[model samples]
Target: MASRFTRLTTVVPQLARGYAAPAKTVKVPVTLFGLNGRYATALYSAAARQNALDAVEKDLKALDALVVKDKGVQAFLENPTINRKVKLDGINALLSKAGKPSEVTKNLFETLSENGRLDQTTKVISSFAELMSAHRNELSLVITSTKELDKATLNKIAESLQKSGLSEGKKLLVSNKVKADILGGLLVEIGDKSIDLTVSTRLAKLNKLVTDSI
Candidate 1:
């Protein structure tokens, strides 16, 4: 399956030939790592060539919602015991009932099914979303604190980051996540870089230093 996925990644343009526009290279906005990243990048390139990025994204969002709401669908995807052909048929039927999704969207699912990667549907969708976000020049900023931070604080942090050149001329999408284990301080993740200022991390470092001395 891994080898098949690798091969599929290179030939994605061929798979999307019927649906996508004339053969032309479409560069991805950001470089993602791993198998899912490769799949997502291929999908993005295909969608971009087809001029159906928004449509494909909408279809994937709806599919994501459906998977979250329907445990049966979720279980079916993760069940490796199910035949790939059966899964492919089931997915096609589901997509048909869900309305006419763009050909590029359908091709994505078909490729996943054929490659025995039905289980990776969710991850692929997420990675595709990340590509879309990057395509739109949106930088994701995650702020983790011991408790929920107010909007004012979040905005201030985002503004500060922008001034500090962390935004790199991109729009900032700020989100706050609460992690009580942090005890105090904040952990900021902007794009691929992270700044750890959590009390827990400081204490751990101190403990390690003391142990080394002892």
Candidate 2:
């Protein structure tokens, strides 16, 4: 039994590396269900086995797009009164029509239905995709901005950040968020440390400068 467990562990990551899709497909990190993130790891293996990581990613992306385009769909799917059969049918129809999700994705939804966990459908799919992406060595980034950043400026930001003392020239995880409250300037957060370049902070500094001059 110990040997079998050892063997399984050895082959899991090998499969994960070979079967996972490109990292660009999933935006957020996946979180597993109760106890440990075992279910998430298993789903990653399944996708890896089928070499359907990208396809499954597309399936999840389709769902994500659907949720964004129709804000009410998530609530409707989660609503308790909705019959399981109806929900399953709706899920299948949605994925099939999208024509991008792999068989693995369909099977996952079916499993969720069997367990009466339709509410977790989106979460599970996201988690599975994230696992696959991580195994592929991709870093997910979150960016915050006061307004939409043009592509060129974004490129500059990425290039400038790569030169920062923290990055030391390594490629980084980047995402953008917009907050009007920043007033002006930019705040860059990479991992634990956040560099504040906001206008409010600048004003505080300037105020200190005047006090010091006095």
Candidate 3:
């Protein structure tokens, strides 16, 4: 019996070889949704089968960097008016210039092109990175504050998180986001849970308290 992925492979001739079977044991521990997640999961399966997970990750990081740094390439991928062939060629040239493009990566690019889904390039790449982070059993710690956090303060917060049992034993991948609307203090999100310590939240609470007392 052909597995669902096997049937899917057949839909794209070039991808069948890459997505056939994982050469090594690779476990995807997380579930994702939506279009980007769907594509990223499929690519993860294909890369795992080829035992090229790291290569694919490296390719994605490089590609993502290109998308961020190069306006022309970024615009090209986002432009729906451009035909599939042109986008396909452009991606190939960009990868070639970067270095030798891995077979699985190239196959993914071609599949996206053929499906006229090049517009999903950025989201897919980001979603794949998220998968990689999950595979490493890491927690995403987003620290939002009214001002940029200094390294020392960030380190202290990370150390506290490490001991606070909030990370649930997984490694913490900490990042800072500045949101002036928070007014003051910090807003921390660890995975699905969040802590609102910002002045805005406190003010709202205070207002509610006063209103209830009236």
**Candidate maximizing TM-score:** 1
Task: Please give, for residues 1-214, the per-residue lDDT of candidate 2 as tens digits.
Answer: 0111223244244334334454332232444555124445555666656666677778878887787688687887899999978998988877776875676776666655655667766676666655765656554445567897887887787777777766644456677789998788888876456788889789989999999999
Worst 10 contiguous positions by lDDT, candidate 2? 1-10
> What shift in Å separates residue 27 of candidate 2 from its native position after superposition?
20
Worst 10 residues of 1 by lDDT: 1-10
- Specify the poorest-scoring 10-residue window by lDDT in model 3: 1-10
Top-down TM-score ranking:
1, 3, 2
Q: How would you encode candidate 3's per-residue C-alpha lDDT over 1-214 as one tens digit per residue?
A: 2222333334333443534453454467688888677778778877777768899998888888888888888888889899989999989887886799789899888878867778889998989899999888999999999889999999899889989979889999989999998899999999999988999999999999999999
lDDT of 3 at 16: 38
lDDT of 1 by residue, 69-103 (tens): 88899899899999988987877777666688888
Please give the lDDT score at residue 6 for candidate 2: 28
lDDT of 2: 0.65
Count of steric clashes across candidates, in order: 0, 9, 1
Clashing pairs in 3: 22-49
Model with the higher lDDT, candidate 2 or 3: 3
Q: Which stretches of candidate 2 lie over 4 Å from their true place?
A: 1-38, 164-173, 191-193, 200-214
How far is 112's C-alpha from truth in model 1 (Å)?
A: 1.4
